[model samples]
Target: MGWLTMTRMAMGGHETPKAYLDAQLTYERKAEGDTPFQGLRVLKSVYSGSTYYAAAERYDENGKRIYVTAIICLVRWNPRASDGHIFGYKDMDEDMGPCEASCPRSVLALLTTTSHPFALDWRRRCYRMLALRERRIADGDLIRFPEPMKFTDGSEHREFRIRRDGQKTVLTLADGRGRFKISRLLERRFEIVREPKVAKTFFPAA
Candidate 1:
């Protein structure tokens, strides 16, 4: 549980919490009819620097509100620096809960400026399924987009969409039956898909 390597010095411009988690997180809005990607379109970073993102959200046990996927990596993606980056990512079948959901790898309120401590023992290892049974995915793959959850008995939030399955590398979660595999320190070579649920499975048994 000690393997974090993010070295990209050149931000004399200041701001380091690993460059504010590699700054560049959009798609903000969810809850109720939630899915992932905060409702698609807001994704940026095909190369930018100072990137460190993590995704995977599922809440229940009476907390209600499920579905959220993400894992956009690039925390040390310095291909000699030039914005050539990207490191980790996430996803789900819009499954909804009980099938076991939790694969975030770290989330102390998303590491509030990484100074450690305040109370952060985040390390979600495994949990996320919708009877997960298919396989195969491609197209510049690097999965994980689950984290699109929201609630506000005051305003109103609930959106979804992080669906994938194309180009070809392999990361399918139900094309043939729903498969999985998107973790390897992301040194290149990614292809896992699973975001074709589109909200409609709230919770009752998972």
Candidate 2:
């Protein structure tokens, strides 16, 4: 064992994989207004080499129970610092399936057993919510104009300002002359504007 592992063990910090997952999920629930998840019950657990996998039933916000799987690998880092080593499972990988469809047979074999009925709606809402929260414009976010810009809305602009137009997020000229919509493209990425090839890349303000 490495020095870190020895220290963690000496500190009496070992924790069952199930216990660690439950704690992590609880933290997520509290952050999202404690909705979408009624409860979680682990159905089966298996170990392969240094990795641990678990399958469970998760009740979503709509009171629908669905099958979920998680994979955790042992690590030496202590995320809580003071909290004794719980095997560092902060980066567990998760997948949700009704089990009958969607999941691979190899992974399903671990679960030993699935509704994806709300899969589409739930995914859309989850992504939109995450985008709105994380991809939002904040002070010091970078904005670049590679060329002069024009808008179909007949709005003129020299600089941009971020604001919301109802449920949609928009970038309006700082002078309030023109506006354009911002879209979430993929995880942690946004399409600010395309016509002028303006780059919305975010660089930490120096």
Candidate 3:
């Protein structure tokens, strides 16, 4: 997937799309030291509005998968608030939720800002709720909310669903508070091709 598509997948309220894109690029640049582009792979889950799953994988020189990390970005829309709060999680288990077992701190920081306490709190609550729901679903429990549920002082109530297509899983989000339309889901996977110059910069001593 292209950077524009990745930007769209990671986009959230409160920041212009361009701003979000810039931040994501900066994060990716900083991550190159630890995870070189040649070994990095990106996989996406279903995207509904501003909520989605993004996973990164690192492969060793022999093509063995060495590490995997996933992030679930949940954006809560509140009309009363100027901009919606964005939350992210790097610590999540597979089958416990839409997130993967590997959690990376850098991924989580992409969506969180320490300057906004309210947004930070919102992200924390949402992360806990999704983690709990993921566990319940994995235990063969059917999860369906009969009523719209409020999240973190937000004016809107939200609902989530998981759909399995062959080997692929797609997460769906619905706005139950009324008059809010969910965006169409878009999913994509991309491999980061390593550039020799980039690798040299990251490992100059090599």
Candidate 4:
């Protein structure tokens, strides 16, 4: 597992597969939603010069996390295609499937050919989870947007700021109870309200 640090390199200018996928998962539609980024977390990953293989965790219907495998390649994400622009780079492609005995053929082929330790450990985790009938995420939950702060009394601040708390990015208020994710603010709908006027300097003219 420690070798992952040394063997890993930027794939398509992204430091990790999760970052690459999230960057390409944006959408611009009338029914804009953030479900694509919802509860998706990458657990184990390995990549060749062109192909990326990884194990991902996703929440199922019963609020249980399930282990899934994915194969992401540049061929699956074509820039010249219209669907790639309309949906997402990976949304239109059939690139992911289960990680257990019912895994997809594409993932199976890649796994069989490679002797990478990360890949082997990833397979072991898949089997172990399946055997226990528990697919709980080993790497913990995905980064989630925090609850928006409520301002029930109609009090507002003149200015605000954004800052990071460890792995989380949050917006701050001068006198608020807790920090809020920028995404949460966007979801809650924010307006400029009013801009502060520039202060005039009093100086003697020469």
Candidate 5:
């Protein structure tokens, strides 16, 4: 419904929240000793009319977590608009705080980043994980989230995932929970947004 559809593999009715996710995501398992939490994610599952990327994550006290990350690229939406852009991030931390978010108004006033990776523990995420394909931070200044900044592209960020009855290409990412954020550099300033995405699939060889 929102920019991204978030789903966490069930982990035993909240009791073993982390374990249940592991079982549900048998096809997307990560290596052992990756992180202290467990989570998974699938980005850009539906990239049609309302396009964006889907991201999700799950955490547990057993030191097991999974994060799913991917993008739901749009095939055709307002074709006349400029080519869409995807922000490249190396790592995200809780210290980033409620990065440029669009959700319940409570997020705007509450201490959202108090527990977030980018805002809380940045080093563990930014310096450790998160490999970026592109970096646009050089274009503009770092603008904090919640401060209204416009994205010119026609495709507004609204992420969703459609598993449907059975689809093969539905790729689930496999990795740890890395803090997520987005930055767009203009002529003299850069704008930052909050975009957290985790992987649901595990690449043992990777």
Candidate 6:
């Protein structure tokens, strides 16, 4: 057969319609998550407009109502169809999902307006981990916190401590009010030494 005839036959033969074949192919690709820009890397500019604030109402020793404000810095990773990433302001109360689990480039860092007694040590430990891993982080790169760092589900959430030993880093998870105490309250602990993979930036240059 001639080239044109062979081409037509290979596409769908005489019985099957070309348009139907094309539609089927498109549906298959979509099912396989093969949409356009599937593996593209995008860069997100850091949020710098305002400081996010959260308040918790509580009673002091004297039973006086006082609102404790928490100043939070949120770093978000947004993926786009184009070449570069986009960053914009998000509401302080908006529920930002755990980007570490979804997108490796997104992160949420929480800081308090004042050192609250409840979470002072926990915040300090988190800060130390950030400092130690700073050298490996780029301006727009996201670092994945080791496993067991989540604090959402009250039942599953536990405090964590990150430490560096020789060439490996360790993450320790514990329950209760004490710091680094391995007791019945100590839920579980594990160690991870591998450095997190840094995400590539697709931001356009000035």
Q: What Cα-based lDDT does every candidate model obtain?
A: 0.33, 0.45, 0.39, 0.40, 0.29, 0.32
Please, what is the TM-score per model? 0.20, 0.29, 0.25, 0.24, 0.20, 0.19
Worst 10 residues of 3 by lDDT: 184-193
Q: Model 6, range 1-206, lDDT digits (tens) per residue?
A: 11111233243433323232222222111124553321211112132333222322233434344433322333333334143322222332212321111111222242224444544543454344444444442222222334434333433333344444565444344322322322322223333334468899898988
RMSD of 6: 24.8
Which candidate order results from sorting by lDDT in descending order?
2, 4, 3, 1, 6, 5
| Residues 64-95 of candidate 5: C-alpha lDDT, one tens digit per residue | 44333221222222213343222111222133
Q: In model 5, where is the ten-residue run with the lowest total lDDT?
A: 169-178
Compose the digit string of candidate 2's lDDT tens values, residues 116-196. Answer: 334443334444554544554543233445444556766544446566567655666655545565444123333444234
**Which pairs of residues clash in candidate 2, taking residues 3 or more apart in a chain or in different chains?**
36-60, 36-61, 98-114, 98-115, 99-114
Per-residue CA lDDT of candidate 3, range 79-193, in tens? 3333333333222223234333223324443341343454345455555544543442221112344455454547543344444556554434433222322232121111122
The TM-score obtained by model 4 is: 0.24
Q: Candidate 5 regions off by >4 Å? A: 1-27, 32-38, 41-55, 59-78, 81-94, 98-101, 105-206
- Find the 10 residues in a row with the least total lDDT in model 6: 97-106
Candidate 4 on 1-206: residue-level lDDT in tens? 01121112324566554466544442222323754434444444444433444445454545466444444433132335443331122221123222323222334433323355655554555454444333222211222223334455555443345455575555556333445443333223233323366899989998
Clashing residue pairs, candidate 3? 90-103, 96-134
For model 5, what is the alpha-carbon lDDT of residue 99? 32
Alpha-carbon deviation at 34 in model 5, angstroms: 6.3
Best by lDDT: 2
Give the poorly placed runs of model 3, Cα more than 4 Å off.
1-37, 72-127, 131-206
